[model samples]
Target: MKMNTKGILFVYTMPLVLLHESYGFFVPGYPTKHISVSPQGKLLSTRSIPSTTTKPSLYSPSTSTSSLALKSSASSDDVQSITATNKLDSILSKLTSAFPFFVLGSAILGLMKPSSLQWTNQGTLISWMLASVMCATGLTLEKKDFTNVLAKDFAAVPAGVLCQFLIMPLTAWAIGRTFLLPLPDYGPSLFLGIALVGCSPGGTASNLVSLIAKADVALSVLLTSCSTILAAGVTPLLVKVLVGNAIHVSGWTLCEATARVILLPVLMGMIVNAKLPNLASKVSRFTPFASVVLVSLICGGVVSQNSSMFLSSKALLPLIVGSVMMLHCVGFAMGYFVPKVGLKFSEVTSRTISIETGMQNSALAVVLARSMGASPVASLPGALSATVHSCLGSILAGYWHSKNKKGKEESSESNKKDFTDRPEDDYPELLI
Candidate 1:
C-alpha cells in the first residue's frame, strides 16, 4: 500500500514538472532550440516541439528543460529582491515604533545633567538640525503621492490645514491667557512660548504617530509638508497679530528664518528624490531613525537648558503642564470630531487630521522662541509640549494598533468561514 501511494504521488507530480518545462520553451522570445541532459545522459534538442502549439503533452521528451531552469533562476532573483525590501520596511517600522521611548529617555537624561547636551542649545545648531529633519521628511515624499492623496479627497487636506492653523494657535492663546498670563513675573515669556507652540505648523513627528495609529500616513505627511511651507508666511503673522504686545517679534525675520530652515531643506530633499530616487530611498531608510534621534536631542536640549527655570517655578509647573496638555487635548479632539461631524470624512482620515493638528512643530517653535530673544522661562513650554505630545500620541498609537489588530483578526475569521462554506468545485482553477 505504501509503495502504491508513492507511485501515485510521483505520477501526479511528474506531469506537473514536465508541463512546466514544456511551457518554458513556449515563452515569448525564447529560443526554439535548447539543449538538455536526459536521464540517459544524452543531449536532447527541444527544437522538435512547436512553439506555437497551445497544448504540449508531458510525454514529449523534446522539451527544452534549460529554459525551465532559466525561468526558475529568474524567480529566485525576484524572491530575493522582495525579501530585501521587506527587511528594509521592517527595520523602518521598528524605528518608528520605538520613537516615543527615545524622546522620553533623552528628555530624562537632559534633565538629569543639563550640561551634557548644552551644545545643542545654540540657535544656529537648532535651526540646522530642524532643517535636516525637514529634509528627511521631504525624502519620503514624491510628487505623485501628494497629488494622488489630494486628488482623491480634496476636502481632507484643506480642512486639516485650516484646522491646524486655526485651532492650535487659538487654543494656545486661550490657554496662556487663562492660565499663565495671570502670573506676575513669568507671565509674558510663558505666554509667548505657549502662543508660539500654538502658532507653529503641524510637526514632523505626527507623520510617525499617524503610521503607528494605523491612520492615513500619506495625509499626515502632506499636511505636515504643506503646513511647514505655509508656516513661513503664516506663523509670523499669527505671532504678530496675537502676541505682538507681549513680545516684540519681527514677522519678516521670522518668515525668513522659516524659509531658511523649513522650506529650503524640504524643497532640496524633494528635488533630490525626483532626480535620484535610488539614492533618496537609501538615505530615507535611515531618516526615520535619524529624525527620532534629532527630535530627542532637541527636546533634551530644551529641558537641559531650562532645568533651572523648571526647578524654580515648581509652583507654576502644574499650571504650565495642565495648560499645554489641555491645549493638545483640545487640538486632538477638535481635529478628530470636526471633520466627522462637519465634512463627514471616514474615521481614519479624521484621526490623521487630528494627529496632524494636535502635534505642533514644537522644535521649530523652540528655535523661533530662542532666536527671537524670548526668555528661557518662555521657551520651557515648547520643550514641555514636545514631551507631552509624544507621550499622548504614543498612547493613542498603542490603542489604535491593538484595535486594528483585532479588526484584522475578525475579518480574517469571517473570510475563513466564507471560504469553508464555498464548494470546492466552484473554484476549479484554484484546485489546480
Candidate 2:
C-alpha cells in the first residue's frame, strides 16, 4: 500500500493530537471534549459531552440513529465550549496587553485611598508579593532558553547585566549628589533611595515592555535573571561603597534577603515549569495580570505610607523628581547607545537592553529600604521610580509597536508589487 502526504502527516501528528485531548480531560475548570479524527487522519470538530455520555458508535447499522443524535448534542456543546474558551482567552490577552495602564491606575488609586492598601506595608507581605512576581518571571522560561544563551549568545547577557549595574547606580549617584545638596536633613535619605533603585535588578515589568516592543524577550529575561541573582551580592556592596558612611548598610543581610525574596522563588518556579509544564503553562497565562496587581499593591503601599511625607517635602520634591528622572534618562540613553555603538548589537537587541537597564526593580529597593530601617522619605523615591519608568517604558513600547506594524505593512506591499511585476513564464509548471 502506498502512503500519501496526508497519511505521513497524520502518522506524525496523531500522537500529539491524542495527547492534547488526553491532557484536556485533566485540565481543571475547562470542560473536556472528544476530538474526532477522519480516516485520513484529518482533525474533525471536537464535541463536548457530559462525562456520563457514551462515545458515538463507529459506522454500525444497528445504532446509527442513536449515534447521530449523540453526536449532534455533543457538537452543540463543543461550539458553546469553544466560544467560551475564545472569550476567556481574549479577556486575558487584553489584560496582559494593558499592563502599563493597570500599573498607572493602581498608583493613582494608592494616592487617592492610601489606607486601602496600607496592609501591604508589612514586611512579610511585601516579600511574598515580590517573590510571587519573581516566580511568575521564572515560570515563563524554559531550560533550553538558558542553554541557548550560554552556548550561542553568552556576551549579550553579560553586556546587558554590566550596563544595568554600572550605568544606573552611577547615574543615580551623580544625580543625587548634584540635585540633593540643598536639603541637609532628608537629602541623605533621598540619595540612599535613589542609590537603592539604581543598584536593584531590572524590574519584571521590562519583560512586558519587551514583548510589546517586539524586542529580544529571551535576552531580556536572561539579563533579568542574571542581574537579579547577582543583586544578592552586588546591590549591597555598591550601596556600601557609595553611601556606607552616610548610612549603615548590612551587605550580608541585604544579600540574604535578596536571595530569599528573589532567587528562591524563581528557582522553585523554574523547577515547576520543568517538571509540570502543563500546569505551569496554565498558570503562566494569568501571571502577567497577577504581577501587575501585586506590583500595584506594592507601589500603592509605599505611596500610601509615605503620602504625608511626600506632601511635606514640597521644598525637595522637584529635586527628588529631577534626580530620579535623570537616573532613568541616563540609563535609557547609555543602555541603547552603548550596545549599538560599542557592542555593535542590532536595534532590537539594543532596545531590549535599554529597557531592561532603565527599568530597575524599584519594588525590591522599597522592600530593602524598609527592612533596613532607612528613612521613610527614602522609600518615596522607589514609588516614584516605579511610576516614572513604567510611563517612559510604555511610551517606548507604543512607538516601537507602531513602527513594527508600519514596517510589516510596507514589506507586505513590496512583496505584492514584486509578485505583480513578475512574468508568468517564470513560474514552474505544476506537477499534478
Clashing pairs in 2: none
Would you estimate the TM-scores of all the predictions? 0.77, 0.76
**Candidate 2 lDDT by residue in tens digits, 1-432:** 244556544533443454344321211122235555434333344445453443221111111111221132346776666555545554554454444455555565555566666788865898789989888877877777788767766778889999999999888877777776447788788888888999997698787677667788778888888888788888989988877876778888788878888889888899998998878877876787678778877877887787666567665656777788888888888999999999999898899999999999988998888778778878878878887887788677667766676675566557555644655554332211
Q: Local error of candidate 2 at 49, Å?
A: 34
Q: Give per-residue CA lDDT, model 1, range 1-432, as digits (tens).
A: 122445434533443354355332211111123334334333332233334543322111111211122222246776666556555554454544455556666666666667766899874887788889988878777888789888988789999999999999999998888888889988989998999999997687787678667788778888988898899899999988888877688888788888888889989999998998878867776787788778778888888888776677677778888999999999999999898888899989999998998898988888888778778777778878887887787677667666676675566557555655655444222100
Worst 10 residues of 2 by lDDT: 57-66
lDDT of 1: 0.74
Highest lDDT: give the candidate number.
Answer: 1
Cα lDDT for residue 235, candidate 1: 95
lDDT of 1 at 103: 66
